[model samples]
Target: MNPTAPHDTPADLSVAAMTERFRAGDLTPVEVLDAVRARVEACEPTLNALWWSDLDRQGRAQAAARASAERWQAGEALGPLDGVPVTVKENIAVEGVPMPGGHAAGDPPTATADAPITARLREGGAVLVGATVMPDWGMLSSGVSSRHGITRSPLDPSLTTGGSSSGAGAAAAAGYGPVHIGSDIGGSIRLPGTWLGLATLKPSFGRVPLDAPYLGRCAGPLARRTEDVLAAMQVIGRSDPRDFSALPAYTGDYTRPLSDGGADVRGLRIGVHTDAGCGEGTDPHVASVVRATADALSDAGAEVVEIAPFMDEGLLADVDRFWRVRSWADFSALDLEDQRRILPHVARWCMAGADVPAVELMRCYHSIQRMRATTVAATVDYDFVLSPVAPMAAFPAEQPMPYTDPSLPMQHIGFTVPYNMSEQPASSVHAGFTPDGRTVAVQVAGRRFDDAGVLALSERIEEIAAVPAPVRIVGA
Candidate 1:
């Protein structure tokens, strides 16, 4: 799309590379957006990564790109990412777009104003290409949805791209654009990042403000390269008045660590979490990739050690129970006719909470508190912890869950959910591939409020591991 590299290989499609070409007069934002939109159109028939809303996304994005080109020609460009193409999650409100939450339940109304994240993207001069699709209410990690249908991975059409952030992952892997923003409550961003072999960050709970922030749901960037994610965080990481849950605006810089040569790791203690303590144990191949990644960190002058499993079936069960009750409450409030439109598995999963007693719900809440405290204390000694993004690789796109049952829905999230409850910053980078070509990735977790440090370390690990990038598309 950028004309330097073929559409399949996205090396030149990265934000940093594209903007550099624009500055040298070798390209124009209009040209790039046109080419990008074309590529997306070509891939859409198979990937199904974008959501079609009533919003005039194309006209608006084209206008923004034209303005950026004029600014560059007049030497008044806004910033490095002035004309970068970005796709927002459909759930996040953009002016005049309905917040469907990926469901066909109601006559969803349009937003009168942009969400904080969307507003920041506009202020930073990013062109809003369109919105990406997600599973219903972001409840499942798989791509199947009642509203958007199944979003198969670009790398392997049979396998899922993983979700809540489903369409964003599919778009990134297919090179739709450099920035595809998504929300991560329990590894929604990083899970897909791993399955699709992309780079994504689920920053500290409040690093990027959300219009309707929840306990551990934070909005962040997803791209093929960590550099692009950093380019995006530079803009959306600002403070906003809308989210009462957000931390004070971030004052630290995210770019310096990369420019100044990543984080100094000579003395950093790194912990390797090889066992998740519940669910099907980590696949041998997945465990091996993680260990190799840790070895690379050890070779980089950091102290690496193994950490005992601090999680169990009970903790994961509690998380599932708490979320089920939350989902049930939301589903109950919807109009009775609308509730019937939910995906069958989701309906079955959430409705289980309808019969729970108040005492059971309180116990689930208390178990979450225990998990938070335990997760925080377990990693206190290490500057960061390295683990697999999941216990296994991607599952079939048509499947509703890895376990394929609503009652045991979240067995795959054990390695990721604790961090959400603990409010820690975590990221996923491509590690390697399984023997069968399924993508494998590792998660990097850092102390609370150390969002920048986590990213800097993640970049360094990416360099050290140097895993081969998955092909642009596999089995297409």
Candidate 2:
């Protein structure tokens, strides 16, 4: 297959389009699965995104496809993603498959049952190709793991792919799958999407169900087009009886002419904050790219307001405390040696949790909850808040970790982590590229449960400042 030639291969087709073709009898599920398998084999050496690839599992998927094809022929089909092949983040469970959670100490744990999100996708008739790679315990920003090596960016192999949803981003960008399901507690979904020039949605917390073993963080899809993300959300967003936090809400038919009503940014209020208290060390190039994006939005008729005085500096500290408590709770079952053998940074993080006093941890937990409420209240007036996703563009892959610059005061937490603390929806859309040929992104944040509003605003901006396609890495 010519990499540059356009074909109706599963790798190049979006979820919505693939479903249409399968339903129209233009292509069979088995043929699409073969195309996807071939693409994965072609890209894996350069991208290093998959945690595991099972031919036997692919065979089983093919068998399921035959059944679906029969149903289609009989004019009795199922959900929107029928016959679509996709990948999931390693942290999410898939029954009978290994959930390594980015560790090398023992064999990947066999999930007793499918995670709620996984079950939803399967029920929708999507085939699980394999699990994508992530950071150890999904705590770090860089997508490097001792067990899986480093997942490289499809655009440039030497640069870091944003993580802990690194593999999801890489897989989607490389066209291994049109949709890659990933989770984000701190820019995990948005960061990589931005770097790879893809679209991602970090839906409002509790909009998607979070079953046992993984709570607090919500999972969503990363795709090349915004409509694909919306379609995936419709299928995944539903009230699950198993998830107590799940809410009853209506899912919109996102494909119905998003542009028929001429989306305009004229007079729409957009708040821009370049500093965000990252201190003077914020990369000048990143700041310039963000400002240019805001200017483009303004040119397209949006009212761009510069935020004054910034917000509470205490937000970052609150985020840190939240991380400590959550990490401790998540890692309690692991033995010390097993933790150490997984990933060094993750083991260090787990060890830090051992020193936190119970009283102090409880205090921090309460503090974070209060901060979240206050922050959400403060942003009620603005339709969207624009900020930088990362302080810099993709950095050298050999660095200990991206976003570790000591000069930047809030280097660890930065702009993305705070939104995670607030439990509000956020997205990182590709703003533009720098003169040095690196990708830069603008983050659009919305009020709690106002995910559609944020997405609407982003679609307008993306139209005005269309980001370029990923430049294939040389000599990968």
Candidate 3:
């Protein structure tokens, strides 16, 4: 034990705390890695959070840590994240790792080169541990994967961590590591992050360059603390020449607000959004949490206005239909027999789109443009908006979708997906926990391309409402 340092966090592990310890010569990268691995070993039996958890995977991280230790010893450490352990979503390509992507199927092809996000993280000297699991095609929100099995919540093993970014949430929640990289399309990152009680961001579209960039997809950070997320983002959220859609070379400062109070909430017009447009009515308890958060912000000298739900059922249906038809295009190319290899729920969900009329599908596509305009228009008047991350508490891990039936699975994303469609920056941070111990979180979303603005508000929310410092993990 390092007598001078003591346990730097509740779990005795955090990216920021661990890196500081390494700087003070109170800990070695290898020692921290071992501590994390030990907890992962204890947690994975119940969590099933990692796609690769073998000796070979450990060796790769072992090599990275040894090199980082040498650098720290010589006072040549790369940066804040050097030697900090992180896991990327399996979908993010890492050379030599087969990207199965949570589908039960034939041999998956190994990536010959790292994806842009993977390369940036590696270049920044953050130790890449094994990749975390996700749903096939990242289509499902819950963590029932045909290939990787169920990813249960660390807070309650009987409940889900929620996905498409399933394993990333589980790993971070279970104290498997400090930082986990996950992608957000719809609510892949934010939804699960809320359920996992993480500080997660779905940065503005193209804020973080992605090799497989899609309409709303972007890679972002998830961690127990906001500071750790900021540290990781500084390294990965940069313009990559490879990403054609990337934002102009990322020169924006995400941490300046925290240090200098640059984006203070004082006198800011913040929207308090209670309705999600079209989900199950917000649970009274969940509504209370959002109201309390908004009340806290109001107390912090922000002008809070009640924003009614601008999203309607037709808009959500149009968005859902468009995604289904898109998924059908991919599924149709697969062998008929091989199609059954994916999660049964996802298969059913996408199959409905196979017969969608070409005219209707085209109409659905047009609806996206309309929804984007509508979403931005509704929230643009305010500096930022506050809402519940999910309409209710965490759901059972055994299910594939929440509230709605599998055939129409976009129900739970009403609050999250709009930001994606609008290309806005949205963050999910801890609000409070339910009586049953499930965590609830509040969403702070800003206008398009206002990632730093969103993050600044998120930091303030953490201060006024309080984000669990050194996050209290389950069964720790």
Rank the models by TM-score, top first: 1, 3, 2
Count of clashing pairs, candidate 1: 0
The TM-score of predicted model 1 comes to 0.95
**lDDT tens digits, residue span 435-457, model 1:** 99999889999999888888888
Global lDDT of model 1: 0.84
Which should have the higher lDDT, number 2 or number 3? Answer: 3
lDDT of each: 0.84, 0.72, 0.82
lDDT of 2 by residue, 160-212 (tens): 88888988988887777677889988678987876677788887877777665
Q: Kindly report which residue stretches of model 1 are placed more than 4 angstroms away from their true locations once superposed.
A: 1-5, 8-12, 53-58, 258-264, 474-476
TM-score of each: 0.95, 0.89, 0.95
Error of 2 at 313 (Å): 4.9
Candidate achieving the largest TM-score: 1
Instruction: Judging by TM-score, tell me the better candidate of 1 and 3.
Output: 1
Looking at model 1, the pairs that clash are: none
RMSD list, candidates in order: 2.4, 3.3, 2.8
**Best-fitting candidate, measured by lDDT?**
1
| Distance from true location, Cα of 255 in model 2, Å | 5.0
